[model samples]
Target: MPDIALVLLAGAVAGTMNAIGGGGTFVALPALVAAGLPPVAANAASTVALAPGAVASAWVYRRELAPVGETSVSALTAISVTGGALGAVLLLVLPSASFGAAVPWLLAFATLVLAYGRRVSRALSTATGRSAEARMSSRAVLVAQFLLAVYGGYFGGAIGIMLLAVWSIGLGLDTAASNPMRIAQVSAVNLSATALFLVASDALRTPLVVATMLAGGVAGGIAGAHLARRLPARLLRGTILTIAVTMTVLYFLRGTRAG
Candidate 1:
């Protein structure tokens, strides 16, 4: 009962975080691991469970979707789907030991990005002094999206933030204007990964856990989308950063103990 409650709470929190910005994986993945699933299985389950929430958030922002620079939304989504599928396949074929070893570092990297991504984006924009009209070519944006999608599929953490950073740096797009597209791309990546995980991974082994989390995720996602309109961006970002930092530290400690 306690475990079930924990998973449900984690899912709700994760869904809310993702809807607000990103870093949901920092919560969902560790909670599943604590629920006694293997790391790889937990990751697969997390991806599958959170997918619907992402879709819901995207739906809420549907009206605001726009082309990323010169790249059409459809083209970016197609690239995301393809890259995410490849990444999911890589997860399925890779040794579990490799994933276990990488988890801590992955969390650390994601935490760092979530913590300073915006600042870094601003710094880059100032350094480059390139106008949006002179932004990276559409082909370059597509390639960057593909790589980020691959990462999102394998172990998404702050994918939304990363996408925003890339688009900000490459296209000089404001975060407010580009956010709808970020949510849409995240939805694409998670949906693609979920499809592959459902067929090829053991994410469904604990059906009850998955179902509980999925339900919580949907509820939270819907609530979050509405809350996003009222919530201050600073407060939301601070809450997410706190969660990311704590999770990253805990994962590092867990790895140390295992080692």
Candidate 2:
């Protein structure tokens, strides 16, 4: 009973974070781990538990969805689904040690991008006398999105923040404007990964825990999305940056302890 409550609380907080920016895995994964699941199973379950939250958040932002650069929302979502499924298959078939070791560095790099991406983009545009959007080809943007979707499926930590960072840096898209698409793409990744896990993994072994988390996730996701829509753009960006920095540092510390 106590464990269920804890998991429920964790899911709520995680869902809120995911809707607001993206650091939910930092909360969900550990909560599941502490609830006595093995690490790999816990990771799978965390993804499963959060899948609905991503979808709910995406729904809340459906009206605001926009094309990413030259790519339509449909094309981007397809790419995310494909890459995410592949990543999930890899997770089921291979050892994750090598990939796990690299996660901290990846988060650190993404955080840096989220922090200085627009400023850097502006400076580069001024120097090159070219708009930031003109500097990155559509093909490059698609490739980057695919790669990030793969990462999201394998072990999503701050994938929403990563998407914002990439679009902001590569296309000079405003974070607030890009958020709806970010949530939608994240939904694609999570749904794909969750489908794979449901069929191939033991993520459903604890049905009650999963159900509790799912309910909490849905509630929190809706509330969080509405809350985010009301926040000022500067405040939203600042919140995202703070979460990104905090998650990156925590991941680095975790890696150090593991090492």
Candidate 3:
């Protein structure tokens, strides 16, 4: 009962975090691992669990969804699904021990990206002296979207933020308008990978826990959208970052001990 409760709480927190900004993986992955799942399966299961929330958010934003410059939404969606499924397959095939070893580094890198990615984006534009408004070539957008989708499918933490960053710089799109499409793409990538997990991965090993988390995610996502406006965003974001940093440090320490 306690295990189930903890998983549910973690899922809710993760879902809320994702709905507001990003960093759900920092909470979801660790919770699952602590609940006795192997690192790889925990990852796959976490991906599966959070997918529905992404879809639900996308649905809420469906009417406002926009095309990516010259690239059709349909085309981008196809790329997202394909890449996401492939990435999920890769996760299932990788050795569990290997993923465990890499988990700390992965968390560390993701934290850095979450923290400084926006500053880096501005720096890139300054260095290149290219107006952020200049639309990217269609080929470039497609290729970049495809690669990000693959990463999103494999380990989706702050993927929505990354996509938003790309669109902002490459197309000069306002974040407000781009958010609908971002939600849609995040959903597409997640749902595609989720389909693979349901069919092939042992994500059902703890069906009760999975179901609890899934339910909590849906609830949190809905509540989060409402809270995003009412709550103090800086405080919320700072809390999430603190959790992420602590988790990364603990994971690295554990790895050192294991070594």
Candidate achieving the largest TM-score: 2
Off by over 4 Å in 1: 96-129, 232-259
Estimate candidate 3's RMSD in Å: 3.6
Candidate scoring better on lDDT of 1 and 3: 1
Which residue pairs in model 3 clash with each other? none
Ten residues in a row with the worst lDDT in model 3? 231-240
For residues 151-197, write the lDDT of model 3, one tens digit per residue. 77777766766676577656665554565677778889989999999
lDDT order of candidates, best first? 2, 1, 3
Clashing residue pairs in candidate 2 are none
Off by over 4 Å in 2: none
The global C-alpha lDDT for each of the candidates, from Candidate 1 onward, is 0.81, 0.91, 0.75
Reference-based TM-score, model 3: 0.79
Candidate 1 Cα lDDT to native? 0.81
**For model 1, how does the per-residue alpha-carbon lDDT over 1-259 read when each residue is reduced to its tens digit?**
9989999999998888888777788789888999989989999999999999889988898888889888998999999999898888888887756665676676676667666655666676677785553658999999999998988888786777678667765666665556668888989999999999999999999999998889888877777777775656666556555765776787678778988
Clash number for every model?
A: 0, 0, 0
